[model samples]
Target: MAPSDYPRAAIVTGADQGIGRATAIALARAGFDVGFTWHDSEAGAANTAAAITALGRRTASSWLDTTDLPSCAPVIEKLAANLGSLGVFVNNVGIGLNSSVVDTSYSDWQRILDTNLNGAFLCLQAAAKLLIAGGSGGRIVVVTSIHAHQPRFGFGAYCASKFGLDGLTKTLAVELSEHGITVNAVAPGEIATHLGPDETRHPHDIPRPGIPLGHAGTADEIAGVINFLASPAASYVTGASWEVDGGMAQMGAQASSHVANNDWRQATRKGTSNGD
Candidate 1:
């Protein structure tokens, strides 16, 4: 088949729910066949596959535990064989643990690091090899987090793993650009998803009160950024971390308070404030 006639294939890990699920559907809608992997949510994965099929696109689902590095190559091989070619690889598999450095156990730290950092590295390596062998320039988009840049009070392990991912993204971007592959990341903050609960209050989840957008973002919003990075439109963009937060990460404690005060003043001026 000619290059234009070849079917486009994309693999999205952790795609059973949240940002990953949204991205899989978006890519399918964009006319790319999808190969998605879920670690524990078989029903959710099947639902995602059905959604893609409903979009008139092909989809395949797999049970992929990202922490298993040795399984990466075989899974990629199987996905490539099933889809014809892999044009995009999304490293969306990650784990977050909320614990202070002193409270975090070694095993918990290792689990978070292995899943968030090592898994991403292994998947990227396997995908790069497959794309190079196929002789097709591919796109690799990693779903990093705002914690990759700014550390939270009780998420030491999570922050460390994401910081490592950020560094890996930049390194891979430099190394893979020569091969016509682009490497980039999307950093989302306070997104409402199964991965991040809205009701469960964590130190990181404390409403900044000063975010310019003034609300938590949705998983679809973050997925939109990831989808864009995987598309032809982002061909010239790489080695960057696009923040999809509602300006929460940009506000310092004092700045956030100031913004809240300003909002209060505006509300009072407009007689819309609830006087306590």
Candidate 2:
């Protein structure tokens, strides 16, 4: 069973693949009954579910397209209902499109914002309301990119959306504190996932001479931090952004993800998160 201090139920958005897939399985191993959403890949979602089930954890999934603002809350509610209740919510659904300031079309800009910013707002609001209604302390983790803090020339739309999320994380942290819900953000650097231009590549497939880690990170590396932030140990950690990059942030165009423990990858009984 999940620790009594926090709800064992968790919901992750865009969980069919990439970092989302890693986090869902991690939470399940940590004793969470996970609820996840898949946009385009039923096969990927099934693969994730198989892993969760193997851990002897209950899981539920739904189709979520963050660009549909009105659909966000209902989908969250449905997932929470399936899991019985919610304790931890991970808002990991977002899209990144490369467009320069001059090359950015109005339509593309809207598409990026609608998914990354506007859609995120609706989903986080819904999750927060559910946690508040439960009257028990909870956790909310947002998956942003390094763009949330630093700017890249070609990813204007993505950077703007992520920067907006950084503010949103702080705002929600303050607003939800009274309800015992801690909110934080995770900013990741180059990772091998389908999200980039070269889709479906392995972690070491792309070499990064600039990244201090010497290679791209895997989804599990970022998932490690997500798992920690949702644990009782991280109750006092809120309204902050943890970068999951491998020493990338040290450079002018770097990122951060600071979970130093490999133990986080495994499941074990955790202590009470006092909802500080």
Candidate 3:
């Protein structure tokens, strides 16, 4: 295919590692020239860019702290300009300050909201304007969490931010329909990444009781769903929040008890794997 016939460019934030890196690679494999942002992991981001370039796709990256709202527009503008077109915007940057309502200081709450919710909104706004100006339909995917639907203890601020992001997804979907822009969310449950303590990449060797699927998900799994949404197959789909968790949301509060009891782990002890 000619260059113009090739897939348009895409921007993925927080792509230094984990899900963000996976999504960037996946999009590149799907034929998009990828541009991504990183907060502190310049090396990780460089590796991700190298991987994409190795895939024969153009890639660009810069340091971007999502909480720095003032920088959103310029970053998007520069990336879109460098790539020549903007077709996909993945709002994958977020942080969860583990603290209860009482323990969560005002600064902590604001920090989480600023990065998780406000930053996403600002980036989305800038990307949407670019898409509209291009006069071509685009895709906007936000990476949320299962906590978005079912709250978790000590995650008040995180849950609230995700919930707000979901709401924004729907509202933007409605407004952007006329422009052929589809807005959606991917709510992942427990996905293992470099960010995890063990750095146990997903598809763990052992099952995890916290998730009904018996193990944490892989970043590639979530990236697959995101790639689908960014593809032509999802052209007609909008305003939807896909729970990419392995049935974690369905378990609700029982998730905690199951984790504590360890009874659910007995199945694995019986010499049977969860089959990933």
Candidate with best lDDT: 2
Question: By TM-score, highest first, what's the ranking?
Answer: 3, 2, 1
Candidate 3: tens digits of C-alpha lDDT, residues 1-276 = 111322379999889888899999999998999998888577888999999999999999888877788997799889888888898999998887566698879998988888889988998999999988877788999898887888766788889999999999999999988888889999998876634376555476557765677887889999999999988788888999999989878885676555566443322211111001
Cα distance off (Å), candidate 3, residue 266: 23
lDDT per residue for candidate 1 within 248-274, as digits (tens), equals: 777766564464434332211111100
In model 1, residue pairs whose N, Cα or C atoms come closer than 3 Å (at least 3 residues apart or on different chains), thus clashing, are: none
Instruction: After superposing candidate 3 on the true structure, give the runs of residues whose Cα lies further than 4 Å from its correct spot.
Output: 1-7, 195-202, 253-276
Q: Per-residue alpha-carbon lDDT of model 2 for 1-276, expressed as tens digits?
A: 223466899999988888899999999999999999988688988999999999999999998887778998999999999999999999898776655678889998998888888988999999999999998889999998887988776778878989998899999999999888899999998766644474666676567777787788888888999999999888888999998888777776232354445653342322211000
TM-score of 1: 0.85
TM of each candidate vs. truth: 0.85, 0.87, 0.88
What's model 3's lDDT at 55?
95
Q: Between the candidate structures 2 and 3, which one is better when assessed by lDDT?
A: 2
For each candidate in turn, give its C-alpha RMSD to the true structure in angstroms: 8.6, 9.8, 6.4
RMSD of 2: 9.8
On the 0 to 100 scale, the lDDT of residue 177 in model 3 is 86
